[model samples]
Target: MTSTTPRYLRPGKGTKVANAFARGVTKLGISLWGSRVLGVRGRTSGQLREVPVNLLTHEGAQYLVAARGETQWVRNLRAAGEGQLRLGRRVEKFGYRELADDEKPAVLRAYLARWKFEVGVFFDGVDASSPDETLRRIAPGYPVFEIRTA
Candidate 1:
């Protein structure tokens, strides 16, 4: 298979609150471990929809891991293929390529290693030290994208 469709996990009340707080801080230009407000065009409405996301840098490349699985922003990103990562006055326009399941293991490892404390629960017990096979096993449930800033 080329890629697995990620399973969506709706954010709980606490997660929603935290995301909101993070977005607020990020809007003021304060990033929490690479946190940024992601904005994508709505597929149907053609209006901008925003969400808070962790931007991971691994092997000198950047990625966005859908730790909450195939969320609205993920779906939107797939359709729009480009969007912005915002931090207050700074707006970074970016393009993305969704990574296949086989390409996700390493990126997943790095992402888990960096933000596990915040996002671990959504990973279904997988940790940074998990073996390649283990990571691959869970890769399908999480979608990853390599991103480039312009």
Candidate 2:
């Protein structure tokens, strides 16, 4: 298995605080601009791990973009193949398929359009208006997953 740890694997203190806040908001049924709490089983421990994720909707489909790059939640989602998206007491079970690097540009673009102000730093300056070539070039660094409702 290729290590999902990206070069920018370590999240700063602010990131942690923001994530905690987002998760709390999600638990209260108030999505912070489409943010959701993702729960996936850890590959090694078989324990559910939760994290705050921005749920992106594009072309009538739902997607999950790993803004921090190949993160632990991304790895766990890959291993589990399925997970739950929670908001308040509402939990939706879903499966996901990882998008190919070449197929990520559109989804990435949409994600950037919605979250650029929050996550643009991680994209190395790429944004919604960026050309496909630019998004594709940086695609490998960010993992995009298509969510399939169960």
Candidate 3:
């Protein structure tokens, strides 16, 4: 079955609902089994946004990528550049930056290596060799960002 098809004992008309539910469950699983995630406050609206993103360590710097630019958490980060991330009982504020073309390949590679399975979504069709071109293509639309503890 394709990603669109939800796993089932058998296929039926409830596929859409099943697929949606499955996707939510999968996202929750990623958050739970993965590392801490942030709930950022919107700069203008004060809305709280959160997402399950990979926690990557590159050259001793901790990094998180905006794999999906459309995610609200990314938007909040872009607007404020600082927010809070919580894991278990700990929470801390962080400063974030949208990475430039030159800095993305290494981070992308690290992100890809850690969350190798979500490459298609994380990279958004980008690869190590052509990340610059991908960034250029996505520049006007979705771009990548990094976060640091504040």
Which has the greatest lDDT? 1
Candidate 3 residue 69 Cα shift, in angstroms, is 2.2
Give the per-residue Cα lDDT of candidate 3 at 8: 21
Give one digit per residue, the lDDT tens place, for model 2 in 10-75.
699988998999999899999999989999999999999999888999999999998877789988
| All-Cα superposition RMSD per candidate | 2.6, 2.7, 8.9
Candidate 2, number of clashes: 0
TM-score of 1: 0.94
Which candidate do you rate higher for TM-score, 2 or 3? 2
- Mark the regions of model 2 whose C-alpha exceeds 4 Å error after superposition: 1-7
Lowest summed lDDT window (length 10), candidate 1 = 1-10
TM-scores of all candidate predictions against the true structure: 0.94, 0.93, 0.63
Which stretches of model 3 miss by more than 4 angstroms? Answer: 1-34, 121-142
lDDT of 2: 0.90
RMSD after Cα superposition, model 3: 8.9
Tens-place lDDT per residue, model 1, 98-118, is 899999999999999999999
lDDT of 3: 0.59
Please identify which of the two predictions, 2 or 3, would achieve the higher lDDT against the true structure.
2
Q: How far is candidate 2 from the true structure (C-alpha RMSD, Å)?
A: 2.7
